[model samples]
Each structure stands twice: as structure tokens, then as C-alpha cells.
Target chain A: MVMVPVVDYLRLEPEPHLCAHECTSCGARFFDRRNACAACGGQGFVDAAVATDAVVTAFTIVGFAAPGIEVPFVAAILDCGGTTVQANLRNVTPDADHVRLGMPVRLTTFSMGEDTAGNEGIAFAFEPAEQGGNA
Target chain B: MSDDIYILGISMTRFGKHPDFDAVDLGAQAALTALADGDVAMSDMDVIGAGNLLGGPGGFGQMLQKQIGQTGVPVYNVQNACATGATALRTVIMAIKAGEADMGLAVGVEKLSGAGLLLGGSKAADRDTWTPSGRVGAIAPTDGRIGTITMPGVFAQIGMQYLYEQSYAGVPLELFARISQKNHAHSTLNPLATYQKELSLEQIMGDFMVAYPNTRPMCSANCDGAAAAVVVSGDRLATMSAEQRRRAVRIRASVLTSDPYTEGCQVLFDVNTLTRRAAEAAYAQAGVGPRISISSSCTTASRPPSWCTTTT
Candidate 1:
């Protein structure tokens, strides 16, 4: 089965992880490809793989959404060491009781769907991991 | 030095649903009322500025001029995010400061009622180039898709991030609800507010959650409204009747700023940094300090000393 990655930064080859465009000057990391660093506007960048393990820094369980969207899902910002990302928290209840700040999570993959041409779409998410992830 | 700008009169239509009037009608109504409030005839104005967020085709200022008056004077129409009204006023103030005109009028109108929220659709994470179809209106959407750009989600993340950074037990939810309760309570005295009734903390916390920690009541409501102000150069006001000079309010210092580069700004989008920077510059310009406990007419009296007064 041919699998297609969801976002450009998501890499499935070396394992399911995210790649960051680290700014050469000021060391700012951006997930999306950049013409220059957002923090410093420096024109140079270094490709770096983000840590797979992370801790929840901030989160919100959205109950309202637009058309074609599902209600009641946990959207979170995770701190992978020094870098931060926006992702969904899976394998846990979408509530304050189950999801929280500093909750340990690890990068994982899920199938979005297979295209009509037999190409399967794969997206990355952070699922509930054991205790002691990134601080 | 250029003459200081002063607000001779200010007024607004009731902030609620206006079933009959469009944006232009509302703006004209507010502008007429402001002229009456200032006791200044439309012919007495030399310049005008109008602001509208979704102000349809054709210039809103000229359309407003059709309703108010068209003296063939300079008319500026502007829109700047949520600051459309303030920017419109600034346009007129700038005209006056340039010594081009002594008196100018500014009106801001928006028919938000019956208008759909701008919370459009999400795009594919990996796609760089955007297709109009990919942006909005898709079925079976995920919260992760809309979390990046939507206001409810952005504010929720911002609040939660602050708490998380302060180690508030995984983004303490109570703090956010408390803010809503305070806003509702303050609205009780404001006649122009759509909802003047105070809401309890329990009610706010129990309301339907739009984003985690922020309930339905916490989100912004789309209401139809228009407000206008008559701005006159202080030098001009002094030459007018004593009553006009007595009632005019002085503008201390008006400043606008955009987000500047800061560490981790890419992640959280620091809303506070620009505010802090603006406040510091305003304080220095106005000769004010953190000790001045200032509050708006409709705002509550209680607040901390200041938020980030130091220069970054």
C-alpha cells in the first residue's frame, strides 16, 4: 500500500516524526518550510528532526466547529524539549480530567484515508505516552 | 507643534440587531447623531473618515457621505482588523495634525448580525499552495484543522499557555471563566452593550464550551452597530464657542503597533508583547506611569499595577 504523508514536515521514512527548519541565526525552529526565520528574519536554516516525545504545554478541547468538522476534540500545544507544536491528543478522553498540561505524549501516525488511486493518506498525532516525557 | 486633536462629540447606536438598516444607514445615523451632539453642522466639517470591517463594494466613506453630506472634501475609508474604528479616527486626526483641516468627522459601522463568523475551514497540513476548495466548507472536519487560525481556539491556547507556563495545574480553567464573569458584571451599567445582564461564574463555567476553557458566552458575538466621533483641532476649538471648548476631551497620546519579533512568538503569537510595547511608549509620551490606575467608562475598577512596562 502506497502511503502519503499529511503535512510536508511529517516524515514517515526514518520513523513517524516531525522535521523542523531551525534558523541558522537565533536558533528558532519552524515546522513549515520558510524563506527566512520568523523570529529573526535570517535567510539561513538548518534542517533538524524534532524530538518524538513531548509534554503538553497548553490544550483546549473544542466543542464547536465548522461544517464537516466533528465536535469535542482535544487540540494541544506540546513542548518537545525547547520547541513547541500544535497537534491533537489521541487515545485519551477529550476532557480536562484525561488531558492536561505537562502530560507526557509521544508522536504517532494515523491513516486519514486511502485515495481513489490507492494512495493512503497518513497524518501524524501525539498519543498518550507513559510518564516522564519531555519537561 | 501641531495642534492637539480633541473629541468634540461621540455617540453610538445601540449595539444589537438592526433588522432594517444596512452598514451605510447605520453609519449615517451615527454620524448625524454625532454632529447633533457636537452641535456642528455637516458643512462645518472639512474632512471625514469612515471604517467598516466588511464594508461592501464601493467606498463606505463616500456612501456615508451620500447619506450625511458631500462637500467634495477628502474622505478616507479604512479597515484594520478589529481596530477599524480607531484607525478611522486616526485618519481624521492625522488630517487635522497635517494642518490640512481644523475639523473632521470619523464614523465606524459594521453589520455583524446575520453575518457568518469568519471561522473558515482548515487546510491540509502538508499542502503549501492553497486551493480555495481546501480552505473551507468540508464535512467531517477535525479540531486540529481549525485550531491554528480560529479566534476561539487561538485565545484558548493563549490563556492555557500562560497558565501552563505558570504551572497552573495543566491550564487552570477557572481563571478564564472568572474573566468572563467580570466582563458580564461590568456590562450591567453599559446601556450600549447588547447584553447588560451580569452572568455568574457558575453560569459562565457551565455554558457550552466553544474551545476548552472558553464557553459560548466567552466568545465574541456578532452584533450590528455604528459609532461616530467629531474630532476638532484644539486650536480650532479655542476659536469656537466657549461651550464647545469646555466639553472637548483632549487626546493624550494615540499609538498603534504590530507584533514585533520575539522568541517563541512563532508558537504562541505573543499578543502581550505588542500591547506592552505600546503601553510603555504611550506612558512615556503622555507622561504617565504604572501608578495611574486608569479605567474605561464601561470597565471595572480593579486591575494589577501594570503588564510588562519594561522595554524589550
Candidate 2:
């Protein structure tokens, strides 16, 4: 099966890691390019990689969505190191009792839908980390 | 040049589904109502600023003017997402302040219902083609893992984060419910508001969940409506009749600022930071103190509690 990233920010191969850019001057990280550091107005930056393992800072279970899309899915903001990534929480039931703040999570991928050519589209998500194991 | 700006007339259509009317129709109706309210003829207007986030066949200002009879006045179309209305008003104010026009009109209209399938179409193909790919000439990421989350989902995540970090006495969800309850109650006093019936905290909490931690009541409803205002310079106000002058409201200050890049650091991306900066600048320009009252359409549970002190 072939996989494609939903956004350019995610990298699927060689262990799923997010592609990010870090400002050389102030150490600010961004999922996209920053011609100049917004924090310090510095013009230099370098490519950076963000790990899949993250801690849930905040999350929600959306109960309404468009057609063909399931409701009550977990959408969350995860804190990976100092950078935050807005993604979905998976491998867990979408309910208040199942999801908790500060829960450790690891990057995972899923199939979105297939194209006319039968190509499966993929996107990234975070799942609950196993006990004493990396996500 | 410390020239004062005053709003001579203000009008808004009832906020509800208006399937029959498009953006232009709504804008024209509101503009006409405002002109009537101010007792100012449309011919007296020097310029018009029209704002709309979603409108078919652009040049909405010109289309609206066509309905009201065009006088060949310059019509500027403004689009800034949620800030469309305020941006339109600000544009007219700046033009007047620059001595471009003594009397100007600003109108904002929206027809979300007319957007049809595009309103919440979540199909991967639909989103991939319509939404920006982040980089030019590149396909946007289509990972299923990210899926499609709406604004409520985004705010709900922020709300959850605030609940975990802040030390509040009551249940965090209750706080959000209280906000919805208060806003709904306040809307009852506003005839132009979409939902005017008061809602209890329990009722708000019981409403269908649009996003976890955010019920339907906590979210803004999609409604078609338009609002308009006539703004004039101090000199123009002085020349108006006593009745028109008495109805004029002073616009002490107007400021617009863009959000700063947070380097994906959602924790530091508190909108209050931008609000505080803009508020401080506005107060300084208006020569007002922190004691002044404030009314804002943007309200989220993630907003700092300190903001409540400024909001009525």
C-alpha cells in the first residue's frame, strides 16, 4: 500500500517524524517556512525534525462534521518538546472518560480516502503511548 | 490633524436565515436603512466600503450600488474573514481621515446558507482542491490522521488545555456553559441577534455537542444578515441638522493588527496578547483609560479571565 502525507509538515518514512523549520537566531520552530523569525525578526533558519512522541496539552471530541466523516472524533493539541502540533487523538474511544490531559501519545497514520485511481490518501495522528514503551 | 470621526447612522437586518436574499441584496437593504436613519441621501455619500467573506461574482460593492442607483462613487470591497465588517468600517474612517471623503458609508453582509455544499463539505477531494496547499503549486497534505476539524474543534482543544492548566474553582465545562448562557441571555435584549431566547447553563450544556467541551449553544450559528453605518468627518457632522448631529456617535479610535506567528507553540498563542496590544493602542489614541467598556464578537473560553473586566 502506498501512503501520502495530507500536509507537507508530516514525514511518514524512516520512523514518522514531522518536518519543521527552526529559526537559527531565537530557536523558534515552525511547521512551515518562516522567512523571518516572528519572535525576533531574524532571517536565518535551518531544517528541523520533530519526534512523534508527544503529551496531550488539550483535546476535543467533535460530534458534528460533513458527510462521510465520522463524528465524536478526538482532535487535540499535543506538546512535542516545546513545539505544539494540532492533530487528532486515536487508538482510544472518543469520550470524556477515555481522554485525559497530559496523556502521553505517539505519532500514527491512517487512510483518509481513495482517489479515482485507487490511491489511498494518508494523514498523521497521535495514539496513546503504551506503558514503558515509546509511541 | 486630530479630526474627529462620527457615525451618523447605524442599522442591521434581523439575524436569521434569509434564503431569498444574497449578499448584495442584504447589503443594499442595510445601507438604505442606514441612509434613511441618518436622514442623509445616498447622493451625499462620497464613497462606499462593502465587506463580505463569501460572495459570488466579486465586486459586491458595485453590485450593491447598482441596486441603490450608482452615482459613480468609488466602491471598495473588503474581505478579512471574521473581521470583514470592522475592516470595512475602518476603511471608510481612514479614507475620511485622509481627507478623501467627508461622508462615507460602510456595509457588511453574509449569506452562509447560500454557500450550499461548500459550507461544511469535508470530503478529502473537496478540501484538497479548494483549501490552500500551504505552498504555492503544491498539493495540500491529505493525511487521514489529521482529518478535518472545524473552528469549534480547534477552540475546544484550547479550552481543554486551559482547563488542565488553570486553577478554577468550578467545573471547567461549567464555565463554558455559563458563558453561553450569559451570551444567550444578552442576545434576548438584541432584536438583531440570531438567537434571542435566553438559555440556562443546564440548557446550554445539554445542547448537541458540536465539538467536545463545546455544545451547539456555545458555538455561533450560521445566519444570513447585514449591518451598515454612515460615518462622516467632524466638519460634516457640524453641518448636519440638529437631529442628525444629536444621533451621531463618536468613533474615538480604530486599530487593526494581524496575529503573530507562534512557531506552532499553541500554548503561547493566546489571542489575549493581540487583544491587549490593540486595546492599549486604541485607548492611548482615544485618550481613554482602562475603565472604558468593551464589546467584542470574539469570545472563547481560552481567553484570559482578565478580559472579563473590560467586557460589559
Candidate 3:
């Protein structure tokens, strides 16, 4: 089997670190960082890892392909607790016809080709769990 | 004092791609032309209102104000998607009619086609929610989620629905093609229009279909253009002649309404009704109706399936 096609060059380090942001004022824990906070229009923001869980709010099966590449499949918009993250859906064969909305999915990592500016495009992918399994 | 505001002058930049110039340069060109056309010096104007659809550094209105050396006048920025020009006109008219300012200037400018993200409306990112089939196993490219439903699709759906329900005799696509051919012909007379050449119905209808029932020639070209209009109170026009008055089309009524989000194609729904409402209000304000000599709309004819294909 061509595991290289499936796995080679696609490096994924599953570091499930806590994702959080630090506000310079009041030192608040904001899950998402922004230029100005909804609470306070604070200018200072520091990115830090935070622990969180995401439920699949919605998903899609992407079947786009480039020249010489097998069509990479991905599911997107896995909602973590409340903050939504877009990720590739792995481990499940794609059925273009049948995929349920709001299906239970988890956060994972995936890879994409270099952009026109020649930058490696890395993204979080959504992994579908077997029935009754929650991540 | 219940009186109609009059358009003193109108101006527009050549509609095409201009990579080097930003929104301000395009805006000022039209503003200067309009001021010159109106026979008014920049120092005499009471207020400046600048309208821009997308992208720029801060102070778009100020950018134009500085360009013309009119730093003393209060400048307001108006941004309203495709209707940016019309909205700016409305603001100037209202201000003049209310006696807030005797002389007001309105300008709309946009550069739609050079290096930037494409627009697919408000629900673009929500495409994953709208069509899950498109998202699987794909790295969402920057332009991937751009709305493909052309202006034609919006109108075609309306036409299709009309055909399906009303049992209309005319083929909707043919009607759309006729509209495009007529507009393309109309643009030839307009030197500032991006498309200068005329197109045959066969040329318009036979071109590769962007959306069903709409062809290439049927749609407006992607353009970088700016439009400006100068307005003055009725008092300013007392000394002017019948010929000069004829040049200034009176704003009988101008009304603007927001979308309620009841339907999927809110733009088509809103525009058809808004045009009617504006017309009605204009007549009521001017004590006159459609018998007035001329009417004009600066609608975005950028793409398919829009009322632009149908309205003209």
C-alpha cells in the first residue's frame, strides 16, 4: 500500500495543548484573540495554549484535486466547545452522497500543498469517531 | 420648505483595471470633474460625502478632501456594497433638502478586480454550512468559497420561478439576452463605461453561459470605476436658465430600506421594491410622477443573475 501517499511528507504532531489568549489589562483568559476585546478595547494580546474540547457543529466532504495529486478529502468547521476550527476529516472514506450535518467529529491535523507564494499550508482536520465515542 | 434637490453635475472615471491608483485617486478624479462640470469652485462647496465599496487605508472621505485642497469642508464616508454611489447621492439630496447644506458633493469609487479576495456576499464563509459536499478533504483555497451564483442566477431563479408558476410565453433566457445586448449598446454611448463596443444578441446569448439563461455579453464587465454627482438647493438654481435646469435632474424622491432577511435572494427582492419606493417618494416630493423627462440608476452590472440583467 502507498502509505507514503497517505502519510509521507504530511507531518502531524498531536500536541493537544490548551489554547488561550492573555489580555494585557485584567489578565483575562480569552479563548480567541482579537485586536480589541468585546469586554474591553484592549490593545495587548498574547497567544498561549489552552485545553478545550470541540464538537462537530457542521461538516462537508471536500473533493478538490490539483494536477498529479489524488483528490484530498476533508471535513471542516469542527466547533470546539464554542470556538470553531476548520480541519480535514480523516480515517473515514468519503461518500459524496451521504454525510449528516452536525455529525460527531474531533480535531486533528492535515497538510496541503505549497501556496502560489510557496508557503506550506498546514491545517487542522476533523476526525470522525465510531458511534458512542466522544473526544 | 418642501422643495426638490437638483443634480447640478455628474462625472465618472474610465471603468477598467488600474493597479497603481487607490480608491482616493479614482474618487477625486470624478469629484473634480463634477465640480468643474457644475461650474463651482471647490472652496465654495459646503460639504463633501465620499462613498467607497471596499478596501482602503483610513479616511477615504478625507483622502479626497485633501486631494482637492478642501480641508475646511466636513467629509463623510458612505459604504453600501454595490449601491454605494446611489446611497451617496441620497445623502447629498437629503442634506440639501433639509437645508443642512446648500451645496453637497457625493462620490462612489471601487477597484474590484486586482489582487484581493473575491466577494460571495455575507454568507461566503458559511458555505460549509450551506454546501457540505464542497468542504470534504479539501484545503479551502482563498478564493474557493467565492459565490458562483452570478447576478444571472438570482434573476434566472426569479425568471424560472415566474415561468414555472405564471406560465409565461417568452423564454426567460431570451429576455435576459435582450437586456444584456441593450445595456452593452447603451454603454457604447457612455465613454466612461468599461465596455465600449457593441455586441449582437447572438454574441451575447451564444457566449459561454456563466449562469443558466445568462451569457457573457449579458453581464457587466468587472471594472474599477468612480462616479460623482454635485447637488444644490433650489435657491441656487433661481439664476440658472431652462437649459441649465434641464441639465440638473431633480430628485423627486429618494428612499432607502434595509433587508429583513426573509428570503435567500434579498438583493433582487430589495432592489425591485426599493426602486418602486424611491420612484413613488420622488413623485410625491416633486408633485410629479413618471411623466418627468429622465430617470437613471447606477446599478452594479458586474455579474450574472442580478436584477441588473432584468431592470434595464
Candidate 4:
């Protein structure tokens, strides 16, 4: 098991934004990027990023793994405003005790590991606003 | 009933674990078998619908076609998790029904044993925390979030709910075993089946539990195999003799749907309901009902609730 530095995803500048298809005709919003608006077949869309703050809608503390990595981290579905994004919560221990639905959170980055071919693969992580703000 | 498109022939490799073969190898075997079974040449195929659960990188469809020496046929890859095989079949049937092509083929190959599920290069504890269960490690969310519950947990919750609702404290462990037994029996009948020796209930139950109430045998084997079918339109069907056409199975219906939103519950259960709706639509299109005498039709009943989870 190798210990690697993990970073938050948003700080990676040019962080991938969640694209939503907006209907010009009916004013409907959809998560997937589409050529034509599903509601009105209008070719309209707006680039949207996960809101800076979100809630830990649901999370699971992972106890299963290989070696060298810390046990029990949280992976959460953050509902920022109206959109829900899946991200890993960092800093605090990932368990039922520390995480809660609707808890305020912010975008961050983390380190993943070496890739399949052995290249370093860094990742973006999210953390609770209260804990991450000081650092 | 009137729209043409008939399955002229079908073939499948014995499903089982094969570390030696890649998905393309399995796909090619099924493709060749279907071609031979239908007495149709590979050169006659107008299109190829190749379905795979875990398609490898670097243009999988072309790679699959290259294996069978049938390159350059507009190869279409249809991937949709466990239902991949049937969805590939539907793609070919729809092509024929739409009159886009008179003769088409669909092939599905899965090489589960080729390599364990790709988990981000993390340690066992990390994988365990992400996966929580199963020998195949869970892929950590490198995208930077934790508590991303995997499908096993989702389906486990579903089973839990079913348990609570049904009030059967016995657990559905036996149901999974029964399923494994039935499939294993079917496999034994299949000469190409990966596992020939049938396991006893004790054996199935005794195998390491991957998820609660779901053991190794009770769950679908993670093996490498391929299935294929050739479909031709009725216009071409009339040219063939009664004996040649007797084996043709018609496509009564095909439907696909996705979850609109997550209401904090597993969406896997909705698949059967949606599939049933599609079947109803297909039945109306064919002017047939459940009361009508029919030879055979596949159902979602073969799907374990766990397989339907979005995250598996």
C-alpha cells in the first residue's frame, strides 16, 4: 500500500462542469448533455457547475479495500441548490457518526493513485465547509 | 405481427470464467456460430450489434469485428449493464423492422473472469470500504467524494425492504440458491456451459457470501462467454422453405427506460415494471395477449435484483 497525497477536484482549474440541457421552448432542465432539448427539441444549454455548497444527501463509509489507504472514508451525493453531484468527502472520518444529509459542504480536490499504466492520477474531493475552511 | 424481422438462428458459448479470453474472442465465437447455424455467410451480414457489459478500451466494436475477420461492417456497440445481451438483440431486430437492413446480427460477450472489476489502484481496505462486499473490489470514486454507496448496498436494501414487507424472516438466501440451481441445471444441458458439475444447496450456501443473502453460486457467475442471433426480414423469409423458417422467433417487443430521478431508493426494481410495460406495448403491436398460445419469451425474472442496481 502506497500513501499518496489526495487533492480536491474543483481546485484543478478547468474542473469539469456539469452540463445541463435547457429547453428554450418549455423551460425544462435535464442533467445530460444533449444536442437537442428533450422537451422542445431546442438546441439550447447552459454550462453549470455544482454549487459551491451542498448537503451530504447520503453517504457510506468504505471499510473494504486493498492496503496502504485509510479505512472508512465518506462518499456522498451533494445537493447544491437543485443539482445533485457525487463526490468524496474528505478531512473528517467518513462514517455515519460525522456525516449527515443537508450538511453544508464545498468543492475540493484530492489525490487518487497511479493509473492502470502507472501514471499518477490525481482526483478532486469535496469536504465539509466547516472543516475545510480553516486549512 | 406484420412488420418483418425473424430470428433465423441463435448460438451461445458456454458461460463461465475464462481468464485467457478477452471480450472480442467470445464475441467472435458466437458470431461465427450464429452464421454457421443459419447457413448464412459472414459477408452477408449488413450490420453488427455487439453488446458487452465491460467493453475494453481502444474502439471495442472494431476490435470485436476484427477477431472474426468481418471488419468494415457498420459495427454498433450496445451496452446496458446486465440487459446488454437482449438490448443488442433488440438493436438488430429494430434495424430489420425499420427496413434499414434485411439481414443483421447481434452478439453479446462478457469476460468477467478476464480481469477482476477495475478498482482505482487502491489497497484492499480502500476497496473494501468502497465495495463493502464481494471479492471483486469496488472502484473508488477518484472524482473526489466518499459515501458513494455501491449497488450491492442498494440492492441489499431492496432485499431488506422486500424482507420487511413480505415478513419472511427466513431471508431470500434460498431463492438465490434455487436460481443458481436452475441456471446451473440449464448450463449442464448446455454443452458450452462453463461449469458442468452441479452444486448442491449446501455447496451454494457454503460459498463465500458476496452480499447478504446472496452467495457465489446463487449469483450469476462472473465468466467469459458470448451469445449471438441472426435476424432476417419476412420478405426474405418468404424465399425460404417452411423447415428453414420454423426455428425463427419473432420479436414481440423491445423497450428501454432510465430513472428520471432518485427518490433516495434503489431504481433497480423499476426495470421489471418498465419491461412489463414494454411487453404490453409489444403485445398490443403484435395483437397478442398472455392468453394467446406462444412458444417462448424471455423475462426479467432471470435478473437478480442486485444486478439491476445502477452502481453494480
Question: Residue B37's C-alpha lDDT in candidate 4?
Answer: 85
True contacts kept of each: 0.40, 0.50, 0.00, 0.11
Clashing pairs in 1: A7-B126, A8-B126, A68-B139, A68-B140, A68-B141, A69-B141
Better of 2 and 4 by TM-score: 2
> Each prediction's DockQ?
0.43, 0.47, 0.03, 0.09
State each model's C-alpha RMSD to the native.
4.7, 4.1, 11.5, 9.4
TM score of chain A per candidate: 0.91, 0.85, 0.51, 0.60
Question: Candidate 4: DockQ?
Answer: 0.09
TM-score of candidate 1 on Cα atoms, chains taken together? 0.87
Output the number of the TM-score-best candidate: 1
In candidate 1, what are the lDDT values of residues B199-289, reduced to their tens digit? Answer: 8888888889877777877776778888999999988888888888888888876667778877557665677778777777767867887
Candidate 4 lDDT score at position A129? 88
What tens digits encode model 3's per-residue C-alpha lDDT throughout A8-47? 1123334543344556774544433255644456778775
True A-B contacts kept by model 4: 0.11
Q: What TM-score does candidate 4 get on C-alpha atoms? A: 0.60
TM-score of each: 0.87, 0.86, 0.59, 0.60
Q: What's the lDDT of the predicted structure labeled candidate 4?
A: 0.57
In model 2, which residue pairs have backbone atoms overlapping below 3 Å?
A6-B141, A6-B142, A6-B143, A7-B141, A122-B143, A122-B144, A123-B143, A123-B144, A123-B145
- Candidate 2 per-residue lDDT, tens place, B186-291, comes to 8889988877899888888888987777788887666788999999999989988999989899998888876665555433345544566677788888888767
B175, model 4: CA deviation in Å? 4.8
lDDT by candidate, in order shown: 0.74, 0.73, 0.57, 0.57
**Candidate 2 local lDDT, residue B122:** 37
